[model samples]
Target: MIIEGNDPTVEPSFTLSNRLARQLWNWVWLFLFRPSPRPMHAWRAFLLRAFGASVGTDVHVYPAVRIWAPWHLEIGNNVGIADGVTLYNMNRLRIGDYAVISQGAHLCGGSHDYNAANFQLIAEPITVENHAWICAEAFISHGVTLPAGAVVAARSVVNKTLQASWTVYAGVPARPIGKRTQHEH
Candidate 1:
């Protein structure tokens, strides 16, 4: 399966018209705002919303938060993305309900194929399941599936599929460390 690679129907190299518009918009936004830190609120929401983020009701995004492309982010209900959480989602990033992404967490949805010519980066969709807890400073790689109620411990590096619910994962390339509060779900 193509993890987060654009849907097969979509072309990789954009036509001139599409490229111009995208460049123009990116330039406009970059020019309009200085890249600096500040408190976040409705303005950020408006900006993300404008970029095509399917943000659900009352979703909280902090200022100083960086998103590569808002258009690819999809969050379900009651998701809490804490301050400094970086979602570098070039492809689809699907977060289920009540997912808590803590501060400094990175949902990296792009990586280069080291063996490929020029090491072209490939984007993959990340699926964070319902009621999952990605603790502070954790890094989740592209195409990873955090099953429902999974708990990723702080500073963990997750690169594989985790299926158990409410289980704690921590390590470089994270593995199960312990059980979580949730069970049978």
Candidate 2:
């Protein structure tokens, strides 16, 4: 077999201790956090804080939500992460106060640089501003930012920034559908 130029077994950029801690936390997440009842949001938040996540007050992360690398996560007050939501935060991921990540929504902060022969990992920060809503099953790609009060419709895929505040976005690439009025809750 021909030898490849790049080493496939090369370790990721993170420190060994960080990786080990995350692996151990996975067990704690599954056993302690996942099986807990809905009212245990505070307890789960406490556990997340113990793992180095900066979680604000009254943030409700449902039992089925999956968070990769909790240390990279920063959530503000009153944020709600519904069931089946996935936060794949290989880089910094910030959710502002009053943000809602609905059921099955995915906030992905990492991707592969396909141009590299080794398929190198690329990471970027994801930000959801205050009062933004990510609807059910929506996918927010790396480096994407949702402005304050912006709304992403169900099953939408957002690959770019939703710049306008109080706007509604939908569709595969997530185009701005309409503006949300202040009076409309």
Candidate 3:
């Protein structure tokens, strides 16, 4: 039953991902996503595995990784998440295949509930389209899309819509810096 405007777009969540409601950040990750500090590569996979992240093979996660909630994230194949990166995925945060998150990049999807009397809590889904590159210290605010093959320059603060496919965006709020060509290699 496919309706046009009334069609369904999302699924219902019935339970929280974590049952214990406790954090053994090091005690758990150390046993699973263990980092040798020497090999570097081994530690990368180990850390991801520890968080129950569905990480693809050969995906490199730096030691400085900061994941708010690993269960809410989905990273695709051949991904490279650099140092000083934050995956503040309070809800669903999807990173597509072969995406590069440069150092100091922030993937923040969590926020406070600004409506209720208490302004208790809020968080939204942030989908990073496939092949996007977020440069150093870039801040992607909640629910912003970085389209496929989009390149965000250093220190860009993206709080709005970002178009896909071979676009170069750079600014305080991140705008189209230049038009890229298919053969601009």
Candidate 4:
């Protein structure tokens, strides 16, 4: 859980360390990561690695992408995360090799338990398997797992684990719309 408190109504939601780290990261992002040129993928990767992220080779993470916590990220080889993407990784978030996270996509890794009196925070892992495509402006909710070769259509919303591989899902609360032809790349 991101926040653990007996009485959240009065207590702080995040720990002091967590808040401090995020403050430091925000400064780094403003001064270094966000201002860097688009082609400097390796440099950005290096910065993320320095902050405890496990990033693989040939990963293209754009300068405009917003990452909540680098320590919660694990990205594999050749994964392309485009500009305007928001990776709200309050929990562990993984992107497998060859996955493409299109521009404006939002992968949220945390939520609140509405049933709780204080609406307790709940952090859950999110996974995008190899060759998966999260299309432009899509919203992926907490604890979701997109299987290998799965495609989420533009502006789609996915809140649960996808069942099939190589399938195309679309619409709100995305459903399988078609099958994608799997190819070895």
Candidate 5:
């Protein structure tokens, strides 16, 4: 069997200026924001907004939530991101109104292109629509969109877009398991 070799000459995915800004912001996020107490949601939101995130009112972002690039993040009103949730948004990541991302859940927006010899970095946007709920420890892959009122069960891995609203999805690759009835909030 022949083995593939990685190319050394591929260009970097981000510009030098962008890298510098990101590194600086990352340092700020680590020491200043990450260690803040749980009730300091407004402080965290302030920091994220300072770094270019379009955050809406009443957004609850726990201290342990890690955002790769705040400049690419857009959070809508009343969204709840629990502790240890990772928003790995190399590209744009939009969380709509009333969306809930549970503890330890990961919304990953970046991946490497396996077809490329150098394993070139590829990024896509992830959109969690209004009223969607991503359960604890769920993994949402790059480019996946969770529709309005969609529910991802605990520890589920979602790779594709869940188009139907008010549905519950679970398991590896996340298939729809049941319908969620609409309720008064």
Candidate 6:
């Protein structure tokens, strides 16, 4: 409900405090978080936690991953977010345990309302359930939920909530291509 029906011309999409906090976070990310060594996962987690992110134990969020707002992220235990991933979580983005967000993947939790004259920004939550594997370069749209053990093939574009668990999805508007072997994690 960030900017649901408001006109962008008249009012700012984000509050002044929010903008200022983001600016501060950008500086911190550039100097402290982004420049950290690849093996310094604990340090990065500490930095993210300081900025209000709920990062669980042994989470492997790579150095090149770009997170728009740390406060909106909730990463569970053993989650692996690889390099070049963009987490544009304007709203809450929950990543369950054992979830793998591969390289160059984009998880966008916000979009613009095209029908609105002012193009109001719409923020929605995105959930990646336990053991879900979002393959390399995949794009997970706003409000979409990937159920447990779902495998999104490389470069797939998922704009809707996937129906089946333990399934593999591929293509532009990702459809279920096959079933994945469900393994206990």
Name the top TM-score candidate: 4
TM-score of 5: 0.92
* TM-score of each predicted structure versus truth: 0.78, 0.92, 0.78, 0.97, 0.92, 0.96
Model 1 steric clash pairs: 3-124, 4-125, 149-166
In model 1, the runs with Cα more than 4 Å from the true position are 1-40, 183-185
lDDT of each: 0.76, 0.89, 0.72, 0.94, 0.90, 0.93
Candidate 6 wrongly placed segments (more than 4 Å):
9-11
Q: Scored by Cα lDDT, where does model 3 land? A: 0.72
Per-residue accuracy of model 4 over 1-185 as CA lDDT, tens digit each? 25675577788778889989888988998899999999999999998998899999999999999999999999999999999999999999999999999999999998888998888888899999999999999999999999999999999999999999999999999999999999767
TM-score of 3: 0.78
Candidate 5 structure quality by residue, lDDT tens digits, 74-177: 99999999999999998899999999999999999988787786777778899999999999999999998999999999999999898899999999989999
Better of 1 and 2 by TM-score: 2
In lDDT terms, which candidate is top?
Answer: 4
Could you give candidate 2's per-residue lDDT for residues 27-53 as a string of tens digits?
Answer: 999899999998899999998998889
lDDT-sorted candidate list, best first: 4, 6, 5, 2, 1, 3
Give me the displacement of residue 176 in model 5, in angstroms.
0.9
**How much is the lDDT of residue 104 in candidate 2?**
94
Which run of 10 residues does model 5 get worst, by summed lDDT?
1-10
Query: How do the residues 72-172 of candidate 1 rate in per-residue lDDT, one tens digit apiece?
Result: 87887777787788888767998888888999999999887776644555778999998899999999999899999999999999998887888888889
Output the lDDT of residue 20, model 5.
85
Model 1 misses residue 97 by how many Å? 1.2
Superposition TM-score, candidate 1 onto the true structure: 0.78
Q: Per-residue lDDT of 73-173 in model 3, one digit per residue for the tens?
A: 78887788887898887678888887889999998886655554544445778988777889999999888888888888999899876975779899898
Candidate scoring better on TM-score of 1 and 5: 5
